[model samples]
Structure formats: structure tokens, C-alpha cells
Target chain A: MTEKELLKQLNKLRTINAEADFKAANRQMLLAQITQGEEVKSLGYLAQLNIFMSRLFQPYAIAIMIALFFVASGAYGLTISRQAKPGDSLYLAKKLSERTKMLVAFDEKTKARLNLEFASNRVLEMNLLKQDNNQSSAKETLKNDFKNEINQAKSRLAKNQPEAKSDKTNDFKTAGSVKDNDHIDVAVPDKKVATTTNQGAGIGEVLEEAQKLFDTGAYDQAADKLNEANKLVK
Target chain B: MTAKPQTDKSSNKSDRNIFLSLKKYQDKEAFMQAYDLYFDQIFRFIFFKIGNREDAQDLASATFLRCWGYVQEGKLKSEQEYKSLRSFLYKIARNLTIDYYRQARPQASLEEAEEIAADFNPGLIEAETSIEVEFITAKLKELKSEYRNILVLKYVNDLTISEIAPILGKTKGNVRVTLYRALEALKNLTRDHDGEGITKTIK
Candidate 1:
């Protein structure tokens, strides 16, 4: 206890002991006696602990983060890799068909000379039913050589385009309207059978109905109908 | 102040006078410097307690002679150890006087000693004014062998409870409690003389 706290006890005994010489010294001496070296102990422990922690986890933690960064970056890169976009497939198909790299090499006004484009490959009979029958042998040859096969391939491709496209109608609808004449090329070449069968009452009929709604000042309803028209057209 | 001289003499404390600063007297040149400092304290304390000039001189001379040996041996290190050695040596001087009593007046009781102590205040001539220290030291000397050793180890030698425990072959807890009881006994003795400040004095 401090001297003040123990003062009452000291006071009571004071009168008695005063007649006699006595020392009542307290913590003053002891506190002086005990040697406390400056905070070197804590400093030592902290230095050791810091070194220990870094040594324990440094390698594994760095490795894990590097691995995670690589994994996420790989996934993100995979997600964004380029794919064929709208009308692109059709464009590709058309270009592929035209390059003489394809089967057909004829121009519209062809008086067939040796088609130097196809001349390297030999064929005996270049036959055809002539257009204006009296034209000539060379003309007939160009006409016959590629006309049948090219038309057949084109028709087959046109049919395949619609079927292939039908499955992706939702994707096409979300991506926005096919642009200008490209729209016709993308849709019409593919949907010949559907258009011939539906007459005008398929996608076109829905668009007409939506247009009527728009004219009547029901724009919201008109937009809804337009979306349905998009679905049908796709 | 005639008392029996202690027969057995195999301790470091017995070799120096309590009031002497052994550190000051530690050099060959300083031998007389130490002799001058402590000679009177040993003489008066021994003479007054034993009530005889001859034996007191003998004990006093013996105290200084042993101090001289300790100094010559170069065992006096610091002020603290020197102080400890001095106080420890005083206990030796006191025990020597007690042994003198044992041999010369074997029939005398300790009560006779206390009666002597009642008139035995050292007045202004002694080293310390604190009667509580003197009283406690006297009582500690009278305590049972183990308890007395622990008491002296605690207060006089200023050893830690941990340090004392091993010395006594007791657990630290046992040492602590024993030291406490010994202290309480000292406290009671102090209260009889001076009621307050005993606790503070020891500390």
C-alpha cells in the first residue's frame, strides 16, 4: 500500500515510536534497488516474431495469388475470343462461293473462251441448253459448265441458311435489326420456302399490325408487337 | 558486556565488522582506512553487550582481523555485497557473543538477556537509530534455526523468496508463508517497542 493509504495505521503508531528512534522507510529504497534495463526484451521478441511470420508464409502466399491471377485472366481471355457475328456467316459463304476458289467462274455476259480461271483443270464436254439458242458454241460451253452445279449449290445453301438461322432467331432478335439490304440477303435467301407458304402473313403481317398500333397512338403496345415481329422475322 | 564466544567459526559473515565498508578498505594501501572505520563500532557493541573490555577487544580485533583477510583475499566486490557482508559479519559477532554466554553463564536464561536489553538501548553511540531494526534483528536471531535463517536471508541478506526457498529446501510457497510468519513475529516485537512504521522499516 502507498504511504497515504496506510497513513492511519502509521499515525496511530507514530506517537508511541516517536520516543524511540526508528526508521520507517518504504518502497523508496526497493524501487531504487531493482534494476530495470530499458525495453530491450520486448524489442527482441518482436524482431523474432516478425522474422518468423514472414519466413513461415511468404512463399506459399505469393504462389497462390500468382496462380489465381493466371486462372482468372485465362478465363476472361477465353470469354472474349472473337466469333463470327451477324451476316458474317452469310458474307463468308458468299465470298467463298465467288472466289473461283468456288466451282463457278462465269460472268453474266460470257462468250466462253477457255476460262483461264478454270483452264488448268481439263474437262471434255462443256454442255448447256443455250439461252438465245442461236448465240454460239463457246457461249454454250460456259453456260453449261457451271450453270447447273452453281445454281444447285446456291439453292441448297439458301435452304440451309434458313434452317440454320431459325434456331438462332432469339440471338438475332436481341442483337438488333439486320441492316438495310443486308437484312433481305440474310433473311430472304434463307426463307424462300417459309415466305412462299405464308404469303405475306408471317413476319411482315406482324410488322403491319404493330405499325397500325403505332398509328393509333398506342406506342407501348406497338413496341410489344414490334418485338413479336422481330421474333417471327428471325 | 561479557558473552560466550562462538566456538564454531566457518562462515563468510563472521569475518567482517558490520559497520565497515569493505570496498573502501579493499586495497593494500587502504587497510588502515578500513580499520579506522569499523573498529569502534565492533568494540562498543561487543563491550556494552558482553560487559567486559577484554573479550570485547578480542572479538573486535578478531572481527577486523577477519575483515583484513577478506580484503586481502579481494572478495569485497560492490557496495551492496560489502553491506551484506558487513551485516552478515555482525550476526557472526553477535553469535560469538551468544556462544560466550553459553559457555561462561550456562545457567542464565534468555529472559536475563531481555532484562539486560530493556536497559540496553545503545543510545547515540550505535550505528543505527532505528530500534525496530535492532529489535527485529535480535528477535530473528532468537527464532528457530530454519525460520531464523529464512528471516535473515529475507531482511538482512535481502534475498528473494525464490532465492531463499532453494537455500532452505522449501517450496517457494512454503518459504513465502514462513517468511511472512517470521515477519509477523518481527512486527509484534516492533509493536512492543514502536507501534507504527515497522513494515516500512523492514522494506
Candidate 2:
């Protein structure tokens, strides 16, 4: 083509719409890089202080300063830890930070999702802890924590839809079947057994029975039934 | 077309002012304004050169990042330290493009260019124009890198010889001559193609 006509055709080629997803991702990546770099630049003295104190206090002080530095960075460290995986030293910090975030979250839907995410993270943490040969008591404590979080999530969901309470009953039945197949004699407290037999069946039924037990001044049995219901629902 | 000269002069003046503001004060607002102003042009320039969206986005970002890096390093402390932000950015893009070609898998850029041409939908352009555009794009890849680059800067980017000289580190006279030679080479490369309309225009 003549240069003029060639230029005209070249202009047409420019109109091909760039893929939107790539554009958005690239923009975010670049903006994050730029902002992060600017943050570090603006906090140059803190970084210098970190180096200075680390030198003064020797090795242990470095860890202290690093913690202080993370706090000083104002949610940046928390943001970074959101992607932390198992075996990362920051993994527990990530979980704790997420819990703190959930506490401040105003929306019920968001809080529920965050609780579910925390529960998933706990499951991942449990697997990692097991791989590391952590004490059985520690593993049990994490299992309890996961179950509690899942119950909280379910409660929030049920608040949104009362019909979800029936879904919880089906979930509990599945849990009961799995426990039966394992044949592990899970130590049910005496109070829990009394309430479970009286409660009929399912998590919703047990919770309702526990409330009735609480009204009769049988607090121990009520607490036990609540705990049992939590495990069953999950 | 009659108002084009006045518009070009005003744009050139604006670029000069932005460059000065950035150089003298390291003004971030000014830098961002420049970025918003030139991002599309810079992206298109790289996209035209590389013929791939991902690489173009990367190299374009790299170009601006490098400029920001210079600012952080206080390299742009004076106007004399650099010519114009536009030229500086284009220079970075050109160098990065060359680096990409050096490290890139052999013939990958050409293959990508061909893929782009082949994938061109006729709805985007007149059917006849689409074929002509494809033919030119294919021929563009066959040209020597320097010739291909000059043609793109002049025709595709519509940069004047004077504006392009600093970016390419060539004299304006040299840019004009090189552009003419590049156009002639492109014409000769496409001579064998069944582009009667273009052949007549080129003749």
C-alpha cells in the first residue's frame, strides 16, 4: 500500500479491543507496585531505624523490630499475610489478622464468608500441623476451633434463611453416619448423652432441647447439648 | 487538516511543560498527568511493535516504571538531563522491545504478528481493507527491524520526523531520509502481492 493508505489501514488495526481482564490485572499489578514502592520510600526513616535497632540489639532485636515494622506499615503486612500458606511463619499471624478483620466487618454476609474462610484455613492448618507431628491435644483444640467457626457460619446463614435449619439437620445426619462408620468411641459427656437422647435427632432438635434444659436450671446439660450440636452440624 | 499544525504546536508545548515540571520539581501529579496522557499512545506503539497484548502491556508498564525509577534516582533533576518525557519514554520502549526480541523465542514475534493478522475479523474493517491491512502487517514483519520501526513511528504513531529524532537518537534529516527509504522498502516487499489498488497508489 501507499504510505497514506497503509497508514489508514494501520489505524484500523488499532481498534481491536484489548482483552479487558488482562488490562485490569495489569493495571492493578502496576498500581500496586507503584504504591508499595512509594510507601517504602515515604517510610525510609522507619526502615533505617529497623536497621539501626537490629544492629544495637543483635539478633533477637531484629525479630522485635520486624514485628514493629509490620505494625508501622499499616495493614500492608496484614494484606501480604492474606496470601500466606502453611509452613510460613506468618501463617498464624495471617489467621489472627483475618479474625481481627472479621470482628470489625459490619455486614453479616461478609462476616459469614470470612468465618467460613477462617474455618477452611483452620482445616489447612490442621493438615499442616499433623504433618509436622504436632501434639494430639493441639490438633484437637484446632478441630474444636474449626467446628465452632463452621457453626457460627451456619447460624449466620440460617438467620438469612430459616429453611437452612433443615439443611443443617441433613448435614448432622451425614456427620452421625461418618462417626458410626469410624466406630471411634468419642467420649460424650454424661450431660450431653442425656440431652441428646431427650432431644430426639438432628442439630436443630438438639439446640431446641438444650434451650429447654437451660430453662430447667440444667446448665451443664444445656452447654453439653450445644457443643454436641455444633459437632454434629459440621 | 488545516487546524492540524496549530494542534501539533499546542501538544508539543504541553509535552514540554510537563517534562519541565517533572524535571525541576519531580512533581508526581505532573508525572501522573503525563502518564494518563501518553499511556494509550505508548501502549499502542508497543502493541504495534510487539504484536502481542501481554508483552505490550509489560513493556509499556516497564517503560513508565523506568521513568519513575529515574525520577526516584534524581536522574531527571534538570531539563538538560533529558530531552522530552515523550522521547524518553519512547526510547525506553524501543530498547525494551529490542531486549524482548533478543531474549524471545526465535520467530515468535513474527508468528504472533501472523496470528494477529489471520485472526482479524472482517466486521472490524471492510473486507477489502482487512485483506490489505493483513498484507501490510505481514510485509511489516518481513522488513528490517529499523525499517519496520521507522514506518510504525511515522505512519502508525504519526510522529513527526523532528519528534522521532530524539527518541531514535537520529538527526531530523536522517529520520526523514530513513523514513522515505523504509516506505520504499515496504512498497517493494509488497510488490508481489495481489494488491492492485495499493500497487497503483504506491506507484
Candidate 3:
């Protein structure tokens, strides 16, 4: 047969539309499964009996339940809080978790990193607030918080001078890192900022500039410089 | 011949919007809409490829479930990525079918294909058409797997060359060439089955 004739004969097969009863049933079942929320209700009578027996152990059971609750809530909160912004309800939860992480962190390096991350989040929150223009007072508070967090991070980095030195050369090797630091430094100007804005410069320069600005009562400018420094350190 | 269902363009767009909503917000209503939109088309595609009703249904359901997992993972974030959902579903179905074949070699028989075709269009297949279908199916089994896949995707499932490319991970030009060669091979294989050959009477 000619190729054209063969193509026409093949096209005839398109008419066959097989019906599978299970297809619809399976789809319904799957959709039902996807839409269904976890049965957070009870595990029924056995679970209730177990809980009642555990409650007889009083303090131990209470401690275990509290631990489980916090762990579960922390996991759920972390997952949902990723999308939260400054004024979001979950934003506070995100911040609380960050604080918890810092408290639990063993090394000064990790603490410094977490502080810088928190300060960065505060900058993002300020940016969002600036865009919304909803709460000048809240923006001011976040700006101050951003400054405080950066100062704390700067202190932490200062305490770990040797590790910070190694990190400066090793961690900030990429052009992207240098570019990011330069971008932040250029956005906010202060003598203290100038001290820390240099590539491979430690947190000492940042703290000095921030302290000078704070002493002069230029709080807003101090906050801006610290925010810029926070971005560099991160 | 039974008339093919007309694809509604607006509904397709709405289905896409629903998919995006499901991906971004985990909206159950949107997911249900998406499930309703593509379920049958995916099942038909799998059924044709696997040539078994039960496995096809299971694989098709698994395909959607896997897609839902991707949506939750935020892998399909953009509209461009979501627009490739059909090809993505087909790819999953294709992989699952391959796995099924690996577990049980030569699982899809001509008789199974005939049975499925008969199940779909019970009254439409007369003795002559049934014999013709059997001959075509028998010859299809003889072709290389790639050739058979292209033929079934093009003819049975009515996927365009463009749509078939991503599922097979080939360029559009490659799909076109493979499809042409596949038709040629099928024709050659079926040549002796009829005195006039399968394609002679066609215009």
C-alpha cells in the first residue's frame, strides 16, 4: 500500500475509545484521598484507653505529650511559615523558630549565621512593610529589630575571630557573594558601614560604624547600615 | 465509526488554571477539576500502551498520584511547566508501563488488545472489522517496540508529533521521522494478511 493509504487505514484506529470502569472509580478514590485531610480526630476507643492509662503516670505522660506537641507544631509551623512575610500571622512563629534554633545552636559560627539570616528576614519584612505603607510604627520596630540582630551577629562573629577569618576567604569566594555584599553596602552608607563593607573585613568594622551612628542618635541610618552589613555577612 | 469527543478549549484553559491553583495553594476543588479533566484521556493512553484494562487503570491512577506529589513539592511552579502536564502524565504512564513489561515480559497480547477494543465498541466491530483488527494487532506485535509505540500514540491515542516528543524525550523532527518509518514498517508487516493488503481500498 502507498504510505498515504496506510496512514488513512491507521487513522481508523482512533475510533476505539476503551472504557475502564476502574478508571473512574480509581480517579474518584484518588481525588478523595488527595482532598482528604489527615484524620486528626481520635484514633478511637483504644487510643482513648491508652491516653487514660498514660495520664495515670501524670508528670511523665504530660512531659511526653508536651514534647510531642511542640515537635509536631514545630514541624507544621516550619513548613507553612516558609511562605510567611513580615506582617503575616505565621511570621511571628517563623521568628520564634529562628530564636529557638539560635538558642539550641552549639557553635558561635552557626549562631552568627542564624543571626545574619534572621536579620536578613527582618530586612525583607521591612521592604514588604515599606511597599504596603500600612504600619510606619511596625516598620520602625522591624528596622530596629533588624539592627539589633545584625549587632548580635557581629558580636558573635567577633567572638569567633579565627573561624570568621577562615570563612571570609573560603565562604565568600564567589563573584556572586562579592556582588551581593557590594550591592547591600552601596544601598546604605555610614562610617561604621564603610569599616565592615570591605571584602574580607571582619564584623569589627560593622560594629564600630553602628555604635558611632547609635551614639549620634542617628537610629534610622544606624539600622540601614546594619541591615546592609547583615546582607554582606550572610 | 464513533465520533471523537470535541476538546473544549475554554475548559482546557480552566483545567490549567485549576492545576496551577492546586500546585500553589493546594486547593482541593482545583485538584478535583484537574482530575476530572484528564483522567479519561490518560486512562485511554495507558490502556492502548499496556493493552490491559486492569494494569492500565492502576498505572493511570498512580500517574495522577505521582503528579500530585510533584505539585505538593512545588516542582511545577510556572505555567510553562504546568502546560506540559499532559506530556508529564504520559511520561509517568510510559515509565510505569515499561516497569510492568520488565516485571512480566510480553504482557500485552493481541487478544487482550482485541478484547479491550471490543469492550469499548461492542456493537461496532463486525466480523470483517474484527478480522482486520486482529490482523493489524498481530502485525503490530512484530514491529520494533519504538515503532509500535509511535503508531499506537499517533493512531490509537491521536497524540500530535509535538505532544509525543516530550513523552519520548525526542525532538519533533525525530518523532515525525520515526512516525513515518513506523507506518511504513507496519504496512510492510501487514502486507500478506490480506489479498489486497490492509491499505489498498483506502482513498
Candidates, DockQ: 0.00, 0.07, 0.11
Per-residue C-alpha lDDT of model 2 across residues B38-78, encoded as one tens digit per residue: 66677767776666655565667677767777776877634
The DockQ-based CAPRI class assigned to model 2 is incorrect
Kindly report which residue stretches of model 3 are placed more than 4 angstroms away from their true locations once superposed: A2-5, A15-20, A37-234, B1-19, B77-83, B102-129, B192-203
In angstroms, give how far residue B80 of model 2 lies from its true place: 5.6
Measured with DockQ on alpha carbons, how good is candidate 3?
0.11
Scored on chain A only, each candidate's TM-score is 0.18, 0.36, 0.42
Worst 10 residues of 3 chain B by lDDT: B115-124
Q: How far is candidate 3 from the true structure (C-alpha RMSD, Å)?
A: 23.0
The alpha-carbon RMSD values of the candidates against the true structure, listed in the order shown, are 48.3, 20.3, 23.0
- In model 3, the clashing pairs are A192-A209
Residue A41 in model 3: lDDT: 27
Interface RMSD of each: 37.5, 16.4, 18.7
- Residue by residue across A72-157, what tens digits does model 2's lDDT show? 45335434444555555445545434543453354556666666566556555554565556466766766566667656765764
Rank by DockQ, descending? 3, 2, 1
Docking class of 1: incorrect
TM-score of 3: 0.43
The lowest-lDDT stretch of 10 consecutive residues in candidate 2 chain B is: B1-10
What is the fnat value (0 to 1) for candidate 2? 0.14
